[model samples]
Target chain A: MDMRRLVGRNFARIRREQGLTQEQVEERSGLSQQYLSGLERGQRNPTVVTLFEVAQALGVTPVDLIQPDNVKMPRKS
Target chain B: MDMRRLVGRNFARIRREQGLTQEQVEERSGLSQQYLSGLERGQRNPTVVTLFEVAQALGVTPVDLIQPDNVKMPRKS
Candidate 1:
């Protein structure tokens, strides 16, 4: 899957897990609901700072938003 | 410290640890050296896609770039 889509999917999943709506996230992150919706749909590319703010609003680290659940660390030789 | 500065510091540290310079990373990541310098200085905010590409060029995951080394995951209750 595309990295952008992966990040979006992770964001949506985390947000849902927190039981927060897009509107609620917007209020906390100071981002527009339209922007958040676009992000959730993988139609938008957010800056690192924006991601930090969104993660903060969702009570997660930015890494959580970007890392797909299935990614495994490569084994050291 | 500000999150942006923290990210920039981490990026510079990791790049140096990999023994790669901005010019070298630029050649691999297809990002300009000036932009990379700005990013490392916390003067530029990169999109998540850009971060993903940078991480790929560095042989690391995007999460590695964003997560501070000292950050500890909260213990499960």
Candidate 2:
């Protein structure tokens, strides 16, 4: 999967897990609802600061928003 | 520490660990040296795509460039 789509999916998953509406996240993150929607749709490329702010609002680490859902565990040496 | 500074510090540390110079990263990532310097100084907020590109150039995961230096381990329940 593309990195943007991966980030979008992870972000949406985390936000839903937190029971946050787009309106609520917009209020908390100071990002517009349209922008948030676009981000969730994988149409926006957010700045790192924006990612941090949104992750903070969602009560998750920034890395969580970008990690792929199907990451494989490291193989034994 | 600020998130930007943490990212900058981690990025610089990783780049140095890989024995890569800004010029090398620039050539690989197609980002200007001036911008890379600003990022290293914590003065620029890179986009997610930019972060991915730079991380790829540095041979690191995007999350590794943003993790703080002093993370405490979670206590056992």
Candidate 3:
């Protein structure tokens, strides 16, 4: 499913919606701007911890960054 | 939130629901059972790629592994 691209796409979309820039997210997430750039570009793969940190920085959940763009899949717990 | 524990909980639940064991997942996901055990025990921090691999092995999406156990948060994309 190309999760790297999916996460990058969602991250860019959500950051824009929140009116946040990469620099702002870098500050909030305690992740380097370079790394954030790589992530947004789908050039870097992040750990679950990194995903959680970025989500918190963006004021969202980890799932928010990884969900499919088309449909909301059903989940149990 | 503690994402490691969340992923672990979700992983175990979904694996059991699918009637698959660690061995089966190892075969399907190409992840070592030792690593999967640590992941299920909340002792390992996995990358997004690993999460996606495990999700695929379980017949679920990456979001399913990281979603909160309580509420199904609303998503835009």
The candidate maximizing DockQ is: 3
Q: What is the lDDT of residue B17 in candidate 2?
A: 96
Model 3: which residue pairs collide? none
Model 1 alpha-carbon miss at residue A2, Å: 2.0
lDDT of 1 by residue, B1-77 (tens): 36667668878988999999999999999999999999899887888888888888788887888888676889999
Residues B1-65 of candidate 3: C-alpha lDDT, one tens digit per residue: 78899999999999999999999999999999999999999988898999989999999988889
- lDDT per residue for candidate 2 within A1-77, as digits (tens), equals 36678778988899898999999999999999999998999998887888888899898888898886898989999
Residue-level lDDT tens digits of model 1 in A41-62 = 9988888888889999999988
List runs of model 1 lying over 4 Å from the truth.
A71-77, B72-77
- RMSD of candidate 3 to the truth, in angstroms, is 6.1
Give the 10-residue window scoring lowest on summed lDDT in candidate 1 chain B.
B1-10
Better of 2 and 3 by lDDT: 3
**lDDT by residue for model 3 (A1-77), tens:** 77788889999999999999999999998999999888999887888999989999999988889888988678879
Which candidate number has the best TM-score? 3
Better of 1 and 3 by TM-score: 3
In the order shown, the candidates' Cα RMSDs to the true structure are: 5.8, 4.7, 6.1
How does chain A of candidate 3 score by TM-score against the true chain A?
0.89
Question: How many clashing pairs per prediction, in order?
Answer: 0, 0, 0
